[model samples]
Target: MGDENRTGMTEFYFRPFSSLPKVQLLIFLILLLMYMVSVCGNGTIVLIVCTDCSLHTPMYFFLANLAAMEICYSTIIAPLTLANLTSLRKATISLAGCGIQMFFFIFLGGAGCVLLAFMAYDRYVAICHPLRYTIIMSWTVCVSIVAASLALGFLVSLNMTILIFHLPFCGTNEIYHFFCDIPAILHLLACSNTHAHQVALYICSVINVAIPFLLICFSYAFIVVTILRISSGAGWHRTFSTCSSHLMVVALMYGCSSFIYLRPSSSYSPEQGRVVSVVYTFVTPVLNPLIYSMRNKELKDALSRALGRKVLHQSK
Candidate 1:
């Protein structure tokens, strides 16, 4: 009995549908609504960016890119989470399924971090050195920065997933979070993974959270300095408005990410981690388009034009 209890079965069983209660339908409906809003909001941002030629500037270019990334980022886990919530039959993901989800999650998320850092730098260049902005943010430089961000994201995610999944999950395989996260996955490992795993987690922290954070902080610091240097009060106000939306986004992403990943696992409960993950994973995506695009005068104009065109077509 002791041996059997100590050594969990390789093929884990999930709870049956019959065992679950009826109120889970309410939870499913709420999750579905959240997923729909996230998808629609990000989708609208992509459409608005592509359609508006006036928004072809570097800031809008990166904004579109960020919107695309948000779409991918939310897709990585929202559907699965909603499905799991609704199924009544709380199914268990195979090890391979979990790994694939983990890969996409980290890939898009890490890339977004790097991309946000690049965007901050872009904003800094635009505001701080407006006269030389064109020369500084050349086509080649922009492409290279974006490419580098994507490549770095893929490389880091690949390595982290490989390292994490290679660990033998010989124990009970119930992931606490709605998705596969590093610390949550670590909690289910049968064997002791003390020093080496901690090192890997630390490295992930530096790459995913710390380094990007420092870059964002430094860029914002420069931006604030540059804003203060502007001679006209109107100029200062305009520049500050241009960045406030992005500042809000950076604060949300970094604040949640820092709390979720940077802390010692012992300090928090898995339940708390799940709730925090929702902020960045679901809420951020839903809020981003509303925050960034809705605040912009050009986007509102384009949206109005698009709506008018649709109305005319219907009349025709």
Candidate 2:
């Protein structure tokens, strides 16, 4: 009986839009389409960048990495979310499964934050100091930056996951949000002293989200000043075009993420949190490829040429 009770307590139930049974099918279909588009779009970006010799630069290299990260991030959460949405009864996950989800969610999220900052810095160098751009952002330096971002992301996420999951969950196994996240898990589920865990999460949020966001802001500040000094209108337009897509992505990602993570645990609203998670995890990935491809002529041309080559080969 004791073993049975312990096993029961270790399972978590997810309440995914439980009240909206009338529209559950619509919601599921929409999310499915979004997930498919997100995968295909990010995959195309990675493929185009890898195959096109002309796109073998620091900028496209980082873009491809970001695409891959989005694929992993979305895959970690989307299928589970869809499953829960489609179930007539409440959906449940094992404690171990929840831990895995939380770990990768934080991991990819932190990597993306740092990667965006690096991309901003890349743009700043290319536009602000055109002559020294190649020397400053060489292949070795770019690789090092990507490596550092991944290392930082995994280390921070690992630490947080260990701290949070080490707590005892004695009762109440229902998690209010769609997937297991740090905030929901710490605030709503844990049955022990979470004061220390809350403090640690706040610090992690500062390091992972606040610091990188500020760096991106500072880079753009300098970039704007440099562009203003370029006398020609065409130079101004060209410089703005290069940075616009990245800026849009940064705004969408950081805005949704900050709202979810950068608040006191007491202030967490499960409904609002789930809605924002959908935007950042599902919607943003689909939009990222469109933002980059639609705004940039170079990527469009590369994609067209790559597709055209495939068509010619298939016809032969």
Best by TM-score: 2
**What digit string (tens of lDDT, one per residue) describes model 2 on residues 40-150?**
999999999999999999999999999999999999999999998888888899877888999999999899989999999999899889899999999999999999999
lDDT of 1 by residue, 1-316 (tens): 1243234433333322223455556656766777788888878878877887877777887888888889888888877776776664666776667778888888888888888998999998998788999999987888888788889889988988887766666655566678887777776553555557767877887897789889988999999897777889899778877888888898998899888778876775777787898789888988888887666777778878888998999999
RMSD of each: 3.8, 2.3
What is the Cα-based lDDT of residue 18 in candidate 2?
Answer: 52
Clashing pairs in 2: none
lDDT of 1: 0.78
- What is the TM-score of each predicted model, taking all chains together? 0.91, 0.95
TM-score of 1: 0.91
Error of 1 at 282 (Å): 0.9
Candidate 1 collision pairs = none
Q: What does the lDDT read for residue 294 in candidate 2?
A: 94
